[model samples]
Target: MRKKSVIAALILATSILIPTHVSAATPKAGIACSKAGLTRTTATKKFTCRKSGKKLIWDKGVALPQATIAVPSPTPSVPTTNADLIYVAKDQRILRHLTASDGCANPNAATAHLQVLIGQNWINVKNINFGWAVTFNVCPPEQLGKKDSLAWVEVYMDPGTTYRWVYTGEVNISNRNAQGNGISGSTTVPLPRPVIDPHPVEGGYGITWENIASRVQDISAAAYTDAQATIARNARAPTAADNFTTYLSPGAQSIDPNIQDSITLLKRTFTLYAAFPHPSKVFFVGTTLDEKDQTYAKIDTLSPGNPFIKNSFDNMYGINPNLPAGSVFTNSKCNGSDALRNTFTWPDLKAAGAILTSFCPTDNPQIHVEAHHGAAHEYAHLIQIQIYNYHNLRAAQPCWMTEGEAEWAQTAVSPDFSSYLSLQHLHPYYLTTLGTDYSVPTNTVWSASELTDYFANANKIATCGATPQYALAYSAGAAAVEALVAIGGSEAPFALDQRMANGESLDQAFNAVFHIDWAKAVLILSDVVAQKMTHVNQSDALTYQTRP
Candidate 1:
């Protein structure tokens, strides 16, 4: 049998043995189903099933009215948006064991849950798209079949564009049998197309267009104990390869205990985090020695804020000379002809809103998953740079268009964008307020989805006329580009703008361009954008009338 099959068999064998401890044959209690009032229709009632022995019984669901369940109380650290209330139970899918719920274990299953938590939601629909971290109480390891089951749960919905119902999948109890142990699960579901409008209300649609696959995480407990000792030994040698290797070299020399455990805790906590539905590649960089090498660390001599080394190379080694120029890098040393030039272009940095830096254990296997998701955002930049170069139009491209395209492509490459497209809910203001100013300081409390909408709307404006205002230019221009792509397919007229800029022309660009029907494309793009906007406007009007 293949290694994967063998490993899976082992997992199944272990799970079967672990959960069978409960001798009772009664059905496990399952959760009750109720609409959260976040979606257009009620979800198939979800029940929790704990092993009662021979059968699984229905347990009382969390008792709260669908609408009342989401009633605003204390604000969460993360802003509460339309997406927060809507929980598409299917997206919570994962396959993980209880003890292996975190670190060096299965990351694909873990990050999948995280992606759901971080996802943006549509307006009116009560569906929630969460990302990264979700903590739940109850469910333990030792209790397994007796009273403990999986902390992670999965709810299956009907496969359709309308509000339909379907039976729930297996209750994913954690492989571990301890209370407060984490678990993860995932599944796919179809959402309805907009019946009312297409445009967004507060800003633009909070759409998810990216996912990650096949992540590797490795973490060590000992490495944390002698962090300083590890760093000291590695710093002396400073071999280029050490930059990448020291991360997991557990017994190299001295180690730090506290840091090591903390790293382990983080790994365990996030292991049950969901994975990105689609991810292209993952690269996790680290210091040469087990100890944190201050010389090449994210907090090196440069600035304390940005957690990246300046003269770093490819996460593996030096840059690939044959590759195209302008790739992102955490460290740069050799100045090859095709080095990861400077950081993102001025326009990209301007549009990024806020820059976030994260630290991870070099040995943590799941670290790569985060790297893939983080780096995937930059891949869109690669495309943006390439396409725009083809057009030779260099004035700061609209922030919305570039970012939106990047966001769109992240999902486009894997798992597919269909899920995000279906789940997104937009506001009308996104269209009417096209070319409006909405970007606030990154520190300011503003909605990420709303800002994206503004940027998207601005890009639409840029597509129609030259010198679209910076505020909303990118959003409008991108929409216009989408509109153009719809009409002409990928080979349409404006398609060459980037190529033309790159020194290609109407004829030459034709050969290199994609081919999509122009008429149908235009109709689809225009209709979609317009419809989204209409729905947003209606929702907004109602809010206005009800305001005291």
Candidate 2:
């Protein structure tokens, strides 16, 4: 009975300890896997089994879903990272010129570009609107001031070698003012040895001798690296305000400094005249240089000796120019005087003349300023011709009006011009453009009456009414115009022209604008000049001060 009880107890205990065994979940025999590329040992055990003789290999770090595995397997214990995505080569440098999230030029959007480098080659990965730097610092080269944007960055690998190659790439610009506070992006550059040369001969940005020859007046290839270095040093682009100017009026001196600035000042003076109340359309394609004796550089536009060239220039400028076939000049003949601009169509005020270029000697930098003043005088003639043509009157009776206003125009251009005006210095001697063309041994001192007679005689009235006997006739006219400016104010020329443009006769216009008649205007001004000349403390000299 005890044995029977013990056997029952043992059986009951065994049943309670073992519990009910359940089969582990695994792929059933002949069951198909849901995934197409399903393989055994190579797959993850998360949901697939790694049994014997099954195809197998690890996919590095590729993730496999549990349900996609063919056979049931245990999940792997390897860890995975949660780091942020980084896609830049020059990550921080690029961020120095980009925005974090907001739109760069705009403020409410995001922009990003990633340039990738694969082995020895550079390839565009994500080109949103990112900018890069050729130099490590002062970096964003193109965005200086308002609307001043440079959208390219070029790299000169093996920069100092003869076989130079440049890797020019696009720069992304934004309105960050280069603050680039939260900007993030990258530019992957290729290996330097195999530099990608965009332009072969010059390598796109080489500072060779050819660049100086072809570029406009002051631009030089040697200045290229300096240009970038200057930007980096200044923290902002080099500007006149910062006093760190490069070729455009460089602050500190270099190989050549004044040439570009000289051109700039001349052009600025040109705009001042062009914007004068009676603005004339004078096409000065570029700055003019009056080089005398030194012809190291030739400007074909001004010294175009060929007839085809001259005729082409005439057509381009709306003028019927005459440097007659046999009369056309070169060398000393043409150098006798500045090419005189002649008028053919008074109505349209079209005129033409030779433009010259020069070195302007080491002694005088102001030669350019003086020549500009002279050009202004010529332009004034154009303005006056337009005025007279507007009134439907051919200045037949008193042609002195043209030279008179032009002389006055010189003073308005620059004080350098005033040296030629008798009224400016109240002196006995004055320099004139045409006067220098002569090699006369004697100085012809004109009495006040002679000056008066030059303008009074109607026949000697074209182009300052110049004749062997009365070369200074226009001096009286110049004085008269100056007197008009004195009494009526600086705007007298335009005001007088406007009156004539409104159909007023010359006499009517003079009376209305200057409150004086033509004869009296000249006679009175000349008389005043004579009285001043009598008491003037001045010398009479043939050696005058004019730009060579």
Compute each candidate's TM-score over C-alphas.
0.26, 0.36
Q: Which has the greatest lDDT?
A: 2
lDDT of 1 by residue, 379-455 (tens): 43443443443112222233344544433332222222233232222321121112222332222122334434444
Best by TM-score: 2
The backbone clash count of each candidate, in order, is 147, 9
Candidate 1: residue 221 Cα off by (Å): 46
Q: Provide the lowest-lDDT 10-residue window in model 2.
A: 194-203
Pairing residues by index, what is the TM-score of model 2? 0.36
lDDT of 2 at 339: 32
